[model samples]
Target: MTETLRPPASVRLVRIGEEHAGQRIDNFLLTQLKGVPKSHIYRILRTGQVRLNGGRIDAARRIASGDLVRIPPLQVAARTDEPPSGAVDAFAERLTPRILIDDSELLVINKPAGIAVHGGSGLVLGIIEGVRKLRPEARYLELVHRLDRDTSGCLVIAKKRSALRSLHEQFRENAVKKVYTALVTGAWNQKMRTVDAALDKNVLQGGERMVKASAAGKAAATTFRRLRAFQTATLVAAEPHTGRTHQIRVHAQFMGHPIAGDERYGLSERNRAFRQQGLRRLFLHASRLTFVHPGSGRTLTVEAPLDAELQSFLERCP
Candidate 1:
């Protein structure tokens, strides 16, 4: 499809719907006015050119159903290019076999490492975009949560707006159970344990936020169980009680047994040793997820088999 820019001529008023309720004001405007630059959107909001129900609101405000948004005239440039027809077909072909579950309300896929969940920050293609291209006839599709670019796992995609909202509620309420399989350096003596710590995210020199364990940060907790022990590395199952940025990785590090191949928070010497032993990607995988289906209230447990590469590396371990 060709990208088109709408003319900046008149003021417009849009009424919110249940589908858009609780969405950030800025995000809603970004979707409504697709071609506009994000900076310009913030500028208009700061200047009070955008109003909610005739009242000024900050960008952080959550819009509600039935609220009116007064949008000011603005100009925007079209996207430089669209993905080629062949690219769409190729993406669909690559992702189709990875589907783990597909129901009326949800689509779960065993996401491959190296592909991001959504496109942004210089990424040209992502799983969400690929799925959308593949299912153009589908009315709605959105990511239920995010996984690190290099973390392979069972990723969920909601098939309807109601499903999306319901899933988000479950996440917020901490009713979802997520389990991960990780290989960490050194022997894990504990059969079962919990790490309770507060984590803070700090933006560094180039605008990347790094999460660290700090007393003044948000509370985070994770439970880990030893699955097996190798000569130099131990395999464990990690269950996070509270979802925070880098909670599992950081908690593993806090336990004095940083995950193998975890360059961000692992011991460099151990990482080099693992690399020499033929390990490449981080030894972490979203092994399983247990939750009640939001649409049907049925108990569901989804699992993603470990990737072949990780399995091979483990076999080579002594």
Candidate 2:
């Protein structure tokens, strides 16, 4: 029996210019078919609806100049079942103390722990989506940087593509200064320390973003300077030189001082120890962010005062 492959989606590769020369087909669609959901894109790919050079291609496949992309007719919903207007309104209601700074070009919010920066998988809402409701007229609001779901602190939002792209360039050049504060188990030998490790995804075969240390992985760097000492832990300022996935948490684990309450990269005994101290979530927070303003071009430093939970922990430390 012959394999019954679905008829390919037919599309023409139009030469817009030299700019769209090297982008993948899916990315090209994301730009071209703006406001279409990502779920729809993946669905089209799985159905063999998109073809390049008369062959099916995955979303990750890159396209070269003069290559034709055949996009199958997509069955799209006329109305996007977006989050309710009231849902967005409620989200804004909660961002009371969470706002750090806001301007025409950017928005800085103090993202709370336990919620993701943006929705992925089962998460229905995130920091960015909530912020979008406040300024619905803006063309785009992209995250300049990201923090883990359990890590809370100053999160940056760029209003326009130019600012977003420029700020990204700054991060690549290491002009952005990011500082995090964490409570780590066991410490006190080095006044300052740097953790250099390579991280690879142990991907759990199917799970997303779960990674482990591997020599074959990307180089990760994190520097730590002890700010204060505790009886069983230390409060330290962590500067991640390279923004690998879980760089700080992984480095702390490598140092044998996994962040207190970090179940994924932490020890049971240490986590239990902090649980007694009232430490709940992963004890990490983006404390400070410094960068040149994209609009004014003046040096600007923004700080998110630690939430009540972290502040109380510090005060009670003996």
Candidate 3:
């Protein structure tokens, strides 16, 4: 049987809470109006059907504690396909053991490969959602940064709005130190320690996003240090100076040493060879992160060792 749900016929004035202070208005509305289409939420926002403190506000405006949000009438369709409670519990259970750091203001985890940081693009759940389920008591939890779904390692989550803002400032100022471990095709030249290139991001006709080195693009740089050498590849530590979409991967490709098992921006022949040797995923891992502890104001570092699959593949490399 099809069922329909509708919001109140009259406008609502909701007072923002401290927990939601730093969140964008659109996101706050999504939480308040569950089951409403994201497009609908943005449409009302653009047309000023939504207002902040009796004034029209844009989607990007951050809400503050005690601010009044005026919501117009909304019609929402009931969702029948919510995942079962058991499934959500199982997902949270699997992630609990992967946590590397937990405190009053921060949570760090060794994010597993194949799980997106947040749900979108046809995925119903991601690391952030799972964490929410894991710690339902948390009033606020937000991703401090993002890692590609195929890359496994240290990921940070902020538990307070202040922490999120501070961490974001640190990232924007390039004060955070991130180190990644990657296996690239061919022997890395000892003296070739850096790749300074500009990358342009583009979406193809089929909707596949790609980044390539271009003369007119965002400036990016990555410092590379060879860690280990094998018969067909070299393991290197890559520290990106500027964070851009797929910066390290594109920089490695620009230097003629694309990461092994990287289907995008990589050599098909080399990928096939690595696959035959049991490399099933991209040979990239965010090995470590160093930043100021947002709550304590102390230097902190978190590390995640390579997973067994990656370790075993390295052992097999001649």
Candidate 4:
């Protein structure tokens, strides 16, 4: 159903909902006033044109449910192009089978490798955007966390603002449990389980991010437990204590046993050998996640089974 959206000629009042509570005012405005320039949004906020509960609030102020939001009149541009027919239907069809868990507050999907979590950096549509396009009826949807394009596993999405805030807090406090399975070159001893290293992030000329072990960087740690052993490779479960960029992959490299098929950090020789062994993508999969349900207040553990290709490649590993 297409509803006409007219620019408010004067100040407009918006009532916050359960799905939008605890979100910053600026972010809320960005979604509500789509296509409006960021500069204009901030200008209105800076000029005290935007208010929360009858009081002027900063852009970072979190608005709660039932809070009255004052938004000044603003123009929204018209769209130039419409999506092709059945585009959203086709996208939803492709993504529906990947859903592992879906509730009013949370969405968990077994994300496949080679697909980004969200669109950016030259890509048009990503998992989140695709979901939004497909589920036009959804009032609120946002990514709770991110996984690399090459990483496949249980990725979580928040269906409500409360869930998002709660999940973010859990991640920040390291209360959420995330476990990944990776095939790495060389035999890993059970004794070498923990890797305490500092990681520094750098941006390349092309705007790609590169993370390395550095003393001056943020603290990162990973605990690896050997799960299986091949002649020249080992399958291990990696648990990252700190959510730094590429922490698990970088820690695997630091241990002299880079993950197989990790093009960014793996040795070319081992990668070529793995490729010959039928490894087509990075051999890292988010196997399990444990956390408290934001809505239920109960501990929940979700698991994603290994993809067919990864299992096939493991079988080929001699």
For candidate 4, list the clashing residue pairs, or say none.
none
The ten-residue window of minimal lDDT in model 4 covers: 1-10
Best by TM-score: 1
> Tens-digit lDDT track for model 2 on 12-44?
334323244444465566555544565566657
Global lDDT of each model? 0.83, 0.75, 0.86, 0.83
Across 65-84, the per-residue lDDT of candidate 4 in tens digits comes to: 78888888787766444346
Model 3, 30: alpha-carbon shift in Å?
7.7
Alpha-carbon runs more than 4 Å astray in model 1: 1-16, 22-83
| Candidate 4: segments with Cα more than 4 A from true spot | 1-88
267-311, model 3: which lDDT tens digit per residue? Answer: 999999999999999989999999999888999999999988999
Residue-pair clash count for candidate 2:
1
Best candidate per lDDT, number? 3
Which residue window of length 10 is worst by lDDT in model 3? 1-10
Off by over 4 Å in 3: 1-81
Error of 1 at 15 (Å): 6.1
Number of colliding residue pairs in each model? 0, 1, 0, 0
